[model samples]
Target: MNAPRTVVTDLPTRIRRAEPSDVGALALTGAATFLESFAGILDGRDIVEHCRLQHAPSVYADWLADDAVAAWLAETVSPPAPVGYAVIAPPKLPLDDLSETDLELKRIYLLSRFHGGGVGRELMNHAIAESRARGARRLLLGVYSGNARALAFYARNGFVKVGERRFQVGGNIYDDDVLALDLRA
Candidate 1:
């Protein structure tokens, strides 16, 4: 009897909880997507170092150690796969001190190869669902002001401009805008 062939196209690309085995691949995917997604918007050195330091094994290990952190990694059955990932966590601040209206969409990124393929929307859907499940009434994120693509994508996903802050990376200064989405409505 012949074994059933696995069809890559039939494999679902939905987001799910990330596993330890996904560390290396996910980091690389995040780094690639960051550089490719921000090519013209950020300084080359800044991007590279950001990925190196932020996506390093230790960083992911640390993230995994956080009990409150939840991440979803996108995958397909195809060879050389893995399309994207998103991470969400409750606000690190005291909820009592702040309003009940706050949650954080920590990160959502995809490989350049998967750009404009609805992968991002799928990830956002998962994140929003998770946040809603957790009783969060709002979602917020910060993006580099120079990263127009990310800003547009966030806006398209229902986030609105809330405010701005200064961020520095690789010795380069940048202005970042804060965006938020009210989930209760």
Candidate 2:
């Protein structure tokens, strides 16, 4: 039997700056989106362990408490459920000439069910706008090499390849392409 697909476009969602009180929501959304995005590309055990530590609520609380960090959460209006999120912090990508004004787009994760309904793009726009407002002249991010959809998203948003790094997830390491966006443009 075929089930009806939910029309994400009809779902009302709002993107807002994440506060300290949103740690739990951000953590849950982050882990859920990460798992859904990488379940097929990454090992199950690694995904579970990685999410347990990296997506912990404490981690998000720390980010929210940091003046130098910024995060935004997207949530449905009626049910008040998180659908996506984005976070930016000081530049973490490997580069010899990174400036003090550069910032990193640590992540922009949206649930797969929200794909094609502009959630990802809205999250990215929030990241970019927040970065620029914070005086960042450039923005950097690392994306897994195998995520063609993510790669295309970044490319469409004016990000260009700058370098590569080995990102560790649990006990495994994967190649990631570092991309940068010139905010001065």
Candidate 3:
């Protein structure tokens, strides 16, 4: 009898827990993705400064060592590259009646090239699961009010707008909608 032939397909992108060693890569990906997502609408200097301060390697290193924070990265297996990432941490702001079990989805950013390719969804799902595993009953995030694409994506994923806040990036202040997802339900 002839040996059976084996067929192999290209490995799909995957999501993995980010470690302290990944701080540099995460920082770079975070900053690049942020710029790709918002540069057209925001001032270049503000974006540059914000990315430097918020997505610096030192900041990621600190987060990696914090027990309250969880992070994940998405990468393609064929030709490895950090395409996206998500970060979840203890809530920085109160969510009215839902304060006790609330966790914040601090960030969920993907390279523009991977935007509609399911990477964002995978990252989001992983973040949600991680939050739940950490005892979070609700997940909250603040997104720019004018970002219709993000608003629609969050809506599709069961998040509902609960409030509004002002978000500052350098000297600019943007109106943001605070959205919440009931993980317990």
What is the TM-score of each predicted model, taking all chains together? 0.83, 0.94, 0.90
1-185 in candidate 1: lDDT tens per residue? 11222223444566677878788867887788777666666798998878888778776666767876778888764453677888887654322333555778878987655556677888999889888888787887778776766788898989997776676656577787877888888
TM-score leader: 2
Question: 1-185 in candidate 2: lDDT tens per residue?
Answer: 11233547888889999988899999999899888878767898999999999999999999999999999999999989999899999987788878999999998998777777888889899989988898898999999988888899899999999999999998999999999999999
Q: List the residue pairs that clash in candidate 2.
A: none
**Candidate 3: where are CA atoms >4 Å away?**
1-11
Worst 10 residues of 3 by lDDT: 1-10
- Backbone clashes for every candidate come to 0, 0, 0
Q: Whole-model lDDT, candidate 1?
A: 0.74
Q: What is the lDDT of residue 62 in candidate 1?
A: 68
Clashing pairs in 1: none
Q: Which candidate order results from sorting by TM-score in descending order? A: 2, 3, 1
Backbone clashes in model 3: 0
Candidate 3, residues 1-185, lDDT tens digits: the string is 11222322243688899999899889999999778767778888889989989999999999999999999988878788788899998887645665767899999988766666677888999989988887888899999898877898899899999888888887798889999998888
